[model samples]
Structures are given as structure tokens and as C-alpha cells.
Target: MNKLSGHHHISMLTKNGKRNNDFYTKILGLRRVKKTVNQDSPSMYHLFYGDLTGAAGTELTFFEMPVAGRTVRGTNAITRIGLLVPSYASLQYWKERFQQEEVKHSDITTYAGRDALFFEDHEGLRMVLLNHHGHEVPAHWQSWDGNEIPEEHRILGMGTVEITVRYLQRTVNLLKNLFGYTVVTESEKEAVLQSIAGEVFGEIVVKELEGPSEKPGRGSIHHLALRVASVEDLQEWDAKIKEQGFDSTGVVDRYYFQSLYFRDRNGILFEMATDGPGFTVDSAVEDLGKKLDLPPFLEEKRAEIEAILEPLE
Candidate 1:
């Protein structure tokens, strides 16, 4: 069975780019590695934030669409994204930081057998911090305080993604048959699936929605990307996705990575993204988030794009 390794990154729509930037960079301390515009909507900005190199598994991206409606939360969409932190101590530190910064947060809770801290970003997108297991700590995860967090205590990777769906069978079948996910557990309202070996990454939780359809809007997840090792892997998956009667766009070059977008049987947008030419392609590891980068394709139009984008600082 070919299974995805874990989550790559989750993309969301936000109304305020500056506020999002300040929150993720200044407060959360995630590095802002890329400052570009959305290919579908060049007039708006697209931002990427993550660990030092903005590696595949440690990224959170955003599409700045101020006019997009507020996303309705229900079934058939991504509910929240989880980020694996270093340790229980990091969690405690964050709890204090959130309070000191006047950021609203929830008390600790146990989910998926791990302790977690739940919070929202400036734009109201939901997020979770967990003590991840079974992966190497990222080399470039900068600590908030001058104190050092041992390598053994750094984040492992994204642990899981929550998906809401109206009907379980179609989504479940898609996961089992097409995506190579095996049902790990099941209940009346939800089922958990683990990806087949050698796929992208992350566990997927499919939850049954009990209400009406939802409308995608701000503070809502736009799509969740599944990691593909390279362009060839993505092409293979693209063919596989299309063969299953689902339409998939050709590989699109995202400055730091290449990706193909498609939706699952349940209508949640998914991206198979590559891990090459990472965040360091444009900036040094120590100086990521210091500048705005334009992909080669968009270089000629840089002046125009720059004119339209709001300044991050």
C-alpha cells in the first residue's frame, strides 16, 4: 500500500495580510519565507510561513482575499490544522505567551492520544499544537526565548488533519480505494484513516457533518496539501487522480514548490506538492522572511505585482 507520510501544509484565506504576517511572524515566530501573489488572483497576495527552511511538513500558507466571504464551518471541508511542537514544556510556554500577548486560547486537552493546545490565528483560522512522535526535529525551528530547546525536543511534523463531510461512504471509499488510506478506527460520527506506505504524510480524520452545506470563506481552510517527493511523484498521482474520473489541474509551479490541485470525492480541495527548491531557493537559511520573492515566471511583471501588493512591514 502506498500511503502518504503526513501533512505537508494547509492553506487558508485571510482578509488582512499585515495582521496575518504580524501574528505568524512576530508572535508565533514562524519565518515568513515567501511573499508572492496568488497565481489564480495575482492582484492579491500569497504568503508562506513556516520553520527555518519552510520545509514541506512545517508550512502554513495563506491567500489574501479580503473580499472572500467568511467560510461556513460544517462538513465536507478541512476543519482545523495541527502543528507538532517540541514538547510539553513548549506547550506550557506558549500558554503563557498567549496570555501575555492577549491572544485568546483554550485550555489543554488530549486528542489523538497526545496533549494539545488549541488556538486561533489573527484571521480566526483554527490551529493546534501537539507533541509529535516518530520524526526528526527540524533543524531550523527557532525558539521564542533565547533559551535553547534541545534537538530531541523539536517538532516531529504535522500529526493530523480534520475533515468534515456530509456522507461518510463516498469519502471513506475514496480514502481507502484511491488514496490508499486504511481505516484505523471508526465510530458513529467519525472515522480515522492512516495513509498507505510511501505516500505523502499525515493521518486524515473524516468526521460526519450533521447539518447543511458550508460556504468557503475567510478563516476557512482553502485546501490541504499532501506531500509528494518530487515532480515525477506528483505527475504519477495526477494521472492516478484523473484515471479515477476526477479532474486534476496540471503541475503548477509554486515558487518554492510545484503542485497539482484536485478535490476528493467529498469536495475538499487537495494539493499534491513537491519538496524541492525549498524556501532556501531565494534566501539564506539564517535570513529567510527578509524579502519578497517573485517566481521566474512572474519576474517580468514584478513591478506591477509589487505595486498591487500591500507592504508587509
Candidate 2:
């Protein structure tokens, strides 16, 4: 059976689109690669942030919902999102930069034998930056104002995503048996799963939660997306999910890619998406995210969408 290579992108909920865009672009120094609306709700913007080209593993996207209430943390929710920096010096640089910018962050600390800095976004979304040891990913974007961050200290891509669950075995089994992940490390409170070949993107950390189930709202993860090699692999996984007695979206084309959505044992949403027809499909590399680009099906309703969405900065 074909298995997921790694994470494609992580989609989270945010209260405002412009604030979300500024935080990722100006504050974090990431590139805003796509400006589109949520597929289900054409009124709300779905903003995508990533490396220079918005590579698969580097993407962090959000669905804007201004009126959504704050999320209540509990069991079975993604607790933190990790971004990879190049070195220990990079971590120190970030610490100093956060202090200078007044971004809420913790002092540098060690986790899993690497230096890290924990911080929260303007909307109180938990995040961490870890040392990635200089893994080369496509390209990275410079600051919009031309005051560029040094290449070495810039974010590499997505790191380990942390999730809280009531029980780990069910989730563990699904990851291993269905998703083709192998447990690389485990402890009483946490277990880390990665691809058998040891690629970085699908590295997931599951922590046992002692509290009640989580409530979804602003600042909660809408879904975690994993990558499949092709559309054929996606179709196979869709059938596999149904055969395993889980309800799945089957196959839905998202213009840039094909996708299938399902909930894991703990009720956290999981998306399996193909890794092709990327963001560049709709917009030029230099001009991506400059204007809203709708899928062909939604093209007819472009005026309606523009009317509904507030201009993102």
C-alpha cells in the first residue's frame, strides 16, 4: 500500500485575515503565497503562508473567521505548531528579535536534544522554532521591505506538529498501519512518529491529555494535511479509509491539488492531499498572493466573493 510521504500543510483558524497575513509575512518573515477564500465558505479568506515558493512541507494556512470565539483547550486537539530554523544561533537570533519586537515568547530552552524557542502568535496560537541543521528546501522569500533576514537564520519549514490525545494506542496504530509511519521515540507522556524512510515533514508528536475533549473555535487547528505522491495514491487512500470504517470526503479537487478529509480516532481532522499543481498553477511566482484567484468553478462568482471578503491589507 502507498503511504503518506510527509505533511503538505497545516490549516488553522484565525479571527482576522489581515492580522494573520501581517503576522506570518511581516513578523515571522514568511511569504504570503496564496490569497483565496475557503472552499466551503466563499466569504471567508483562506490565507497561505510559506517559504519563497510555498513548498508542500513549508505551508501554514488559515481560515479567517472574525466572529469565531476563542478555542477551549482540552484533549484531542493540536496544541502547538513547530517551524524549523537553521541553527542554535538562529534560535538566539529569534530570542533577541522577539524581545526587540515585543512578540510574546519564552527564553531559549532545550527540547528533544535541540535548542528551541516557544512563542505565541497575536491570536494566542502556540508555536515553537527548532534547529533543523540546514536542510535545503526550494527557496525562501526575503522581507517585503527589503530588510532581509540572513539566509542561515530563516525558517527552514514545518517541524514537528504536537497533538494532544486521550489515548495514544489507537492513534498510534492508525499511523503505523494505515499511514505507514514508524515510532522513532516514545515516553509516558509523548510518542513521536515519522516516515519509515525518516523524512521530516510528517513528524508528529502525540501527548496524552488528562482533560476533557477540546472545543473548536478561533486559534484551533482546522485540519492537518499529509502528502500523497499522486492522485492515484490519494484515490487508494480514500478507499482504504472507507474500508477501515471511517467516513471520508472520498475525492475532492481543490484546484491546486486533490484532497480527502477524515477524522482520526481522537476526532482531530486529517487531510490527505496530492502534491502537484501547486500554487504557481494559478499565479506567477513573483505575483502570488497579490490578488484573489478563485478556482475555475468559482470563477463565475468572483464578484460575489470579492464583495464578501474584506481586503487583506
Candidate achieving the largest lDDT: 2
Clashing pairs in 2: none
Q: How does candidate 1 fare on TM-score?
A: 0.89
Instruction: Quote model 2's TM-score.
Output: 0.95
Off by over 4 Å in 2: 136-147
Which of the numbered candidates is closest to the native, going by highest TM-score?
2
Model 1: lDDT equals 0.75
Error of 2 at 224 (Å): 0.5
lDDT of 1 by residue, 1-313 (tens): 2345556788889888999888887677676777778877788988988766677777888999878777777778888787777678777877887898888788878665578888887667887877653444434344323123344444444666888888877777887888778788788878888774322136777889878767788888989888777788788888888999998998988868899998877888988888787877877777666676777777898889888888989
**Reference-based lDDT, each prediction:** 0.75, 0.84
Q: What is the TM-score of each candidate against the true structure?
A: 0.89, 0.95
Q: Candidate 2's residue-wise lDDT over 150-242, tens digit each? A: 777887788788888998877777888888788888888788898634645568888897879888888788788988889998998999889
